[model samples]
Structures are given as C-alpha cells and as structure tokens.
Target: MATLADRLDRCYSGAIYDVMRDMGLRPGVLPRTIRGLVPDQRVAGPVFTVRGRPDPEVDAHTSLLEWTGLLSRAPAGHVIVCQPQDDTRALMGELSAEALKLRGVRGYIVDGGCRDTELIIEQGFPVFCRYTTPVDIVAAWRPEAFDEPVTIGNVTIRAGDFVLADRDGIIVIPADRAKEIIARTEAVIATESELRRAIRAGEDPQRAYLQYGKF
Candidate 1:
C-alpha cells in the first residue's frame, strides 16, 4: 500500500487540478487557518474533512479544543481540511498545528484564515489558504460538524478524498479515482516532457502544443 506521503510526493497540485478540471469536477479549498510549517512542504493524503457554519451565539473555544482532540486520533498521514463558514476567523493556530504534527498529519488546506504565521513557517509545515489574520476562533464561531462535505471555490470535497496540495494550490482526487488519475497524470507528464524537448529542438510551440494537447 502506498503511504500518503508517497502519493503526495508523486503528484503536484497543478496536475491534479488539471485532471479534475478535465473531468468536470469542482473541488473546494481547505481552511486557511491550517497552514504549512515547513518551507516548500507539500502534503498529499486522505482528507479528514470538517465543516463549520457560523454560530455567533455558540462559544467555539471549547469546540476547537474538542475538535483538536478528535483530530489527534486521525490515522497517520491524514490531512485535516476544515471549511469554516466564516472565512474571517482564524480557526487554526500554533497549538492546533503542534497537536496535528504529533499525530503525523501531512498538512492542512484551508479557505479561511490562520494565525501564528511566523511559528508555522518556522515549523516547516505546508499550509494553503486565502489569507492570514491575527483573530482566533473563540466566541465567534463553533464547529458544527465533522467528517462531512464542504465546498471551497468550485470544488466539492468530502471526507476521505485524496488531497494533494502544493505552492500552486490544492486538488482533491476522489478516493475511487486515485489510481486512474495517477495513471493519467503520469502520461501527461511524459507527454509534456517530450513536447518540451521538441520545442527546445526548434519545433514550433504551437505545433508541439497541438500535437500533445498541452503547453
């Protein structure tokens, strides 16, 4: 069986995204609070997804604590992707990152916001998000559920989907399509390489692109 890290290292966010786009599937972004701790650190793993809706009346401090506890039990290399209804709150921070790190998590992809940017960057964890903020998730919001489906951008992400994220962005490959996508992606890479070689050898870029259907 291939480990999560192994699969992640084998693919790039761009390739996976292209595959999904070609297939007409839209995937969402992981929460922004979850970030990378290392430089150039990309994570590929099965998503242990969470969905949170706005609840100004509920106290989220306790909910976050409990959520972190649940995440600690996630299988090794499981990437925790959270979708908070409100993109403004900083749902992830140093403490949460530390806990996830201990659990052998691959990384995080969030659409909201994050804090402790300096520490997270220093820790060399890979995180992808819309922005960073100093505000924390506390009295503002609560985690309404887990292991549920969420949407980011045009992508629909469900728990257990294979997630590959890098500097370009995040891509979710349905669990059932992992092997197929991997095979297709390999062919794409090879074709692109050949096309590049042809271009370098003085072939017209347009001709090369048309021949391979890729630039």
Candidate 2:
C-alpha cells in the first residue's frame, strides 16, 4: 500500500488545494516569496520543521556545528521545512544540500537564502527558498528548535503536517486529513478528465460543467 506521503507525492498542487478548499479545510498557502528553485520538480511528504534565527554573538565553529547538527537530526524520507526567520545570510548551502539528499531527505523549503545554487541544482535536489546568496550561516545563524511549530506567511505548520509543492505553489495539509483529501482529489481529477473530454467533443463548456458539476 502506498503511504500518505507516496500518494500525496503523486498529486498536484492545484488539485490538492481545490480538494482541501472543497472539504472546508481552507488550507494556508505558503508565502509566494518562497518558491522552488527547481520549478519542474514536485515534492510532497510529511514535514520535519526547523525554526532558527540569527545569533551574531555565536562563534563560527559553534554555528557550523549547530548547523550540521540540524542536518544530522533530520529523518530520512521527510521534507525539511524551515523558517529561518532571517534573510541576511544563506541558510542552506552545497554541503548541506548534499548531506540531506544522500540521507534520503525528500527536499528543503526555507523562507531564507540558499548558497551554491549551481551545485545544488546540478545535484537534482529539490530546494525551495526566497533567494540565494554566497554569504552563509557560519556565525550568523543557529537552529533554535526542530519538530516544533513554525509559521510561514499565514500558515502555522507543525512537524507532522503534510506538504505538496510544485510550480503552482505550496500548500500545507493537516496530517489528519491527508487520506480524505487525497481520495477526494482523485475523484475530482477523474471528473475533470471527463469534463475535458466532453468539451473537446464539441459539447458546450457550460453544459459540460453542468453535467459534471465541475469544469
């Protein structure tokens, strides 16, 4: 049987959002400023949330140890969603991305900066962030907590919540509703296929929408 993450990985962002809205969840969309560096790639999985901030007083060595510790603590088969809370320096970089990827981490999404863009992109790792910079989080930042609640835009995300992201945008789905939302989205997609065929077969668009109760 496919796990919820596997099933969700197969669903697109739009359909998932529509299903959640129709189901009255009214899910919170992640900030538009935060977008996938690899737009053609889609990543979906349960989140391992990281919340961190700048610590200028910390030494570079200590900050690096703390940074690598974050990577080490991330569980395999999970997407790391981070609210770095500071945009002055890159929160992710080449070595971090490579480490996370080799460990079977699904992806990285951060509301901050990323360094080593070319290398990370070439590595085929999924990274979504606000921007890129050569300046890294050596002594400028430190992880405050993991698996704790973090907010991005209007969404207050918990560690276990499910996330589906693609070119359209990213949306958070409460873990408890993953199965229900996925099942409904499958039904909606089937209806859309039928409606599309009807429209292509010369049926009036409005009539097809009426017939299928959707368009």
At residue 21, give the lDDT of candidate 2. Answer: 82
Put down candidate 2 lDDT per residue, 74-160, tens digits, no spaces: 999999999999978998888899999999999999989998988999999999999988898888899999999999988999988
Q: Output the lDDT of residue 94, model 1.
A: 80
By TM-score, how accurate is candidate 2?
Answer: 0.97
Runs off by more than 4 Å, candidate 1: 1-5, 21-41, 54-61, 210-213
Question: lDDT of model 1 at residue 135?
Answer: 83
Clashes of each: 23, 0
Question: Candidate 2 at residue 119, lDDT?
Answer: 92
The worst-scoring run of ten residues by lDDT in candidate 2 lies at: 19-28
Query: Which whole-number lDDT from 0 to 100 does residue 46 have in model 2?
Result: 93
lDDT of 2 at 136: 86
Worst 10 residues of 1 by lDDT: 30-39
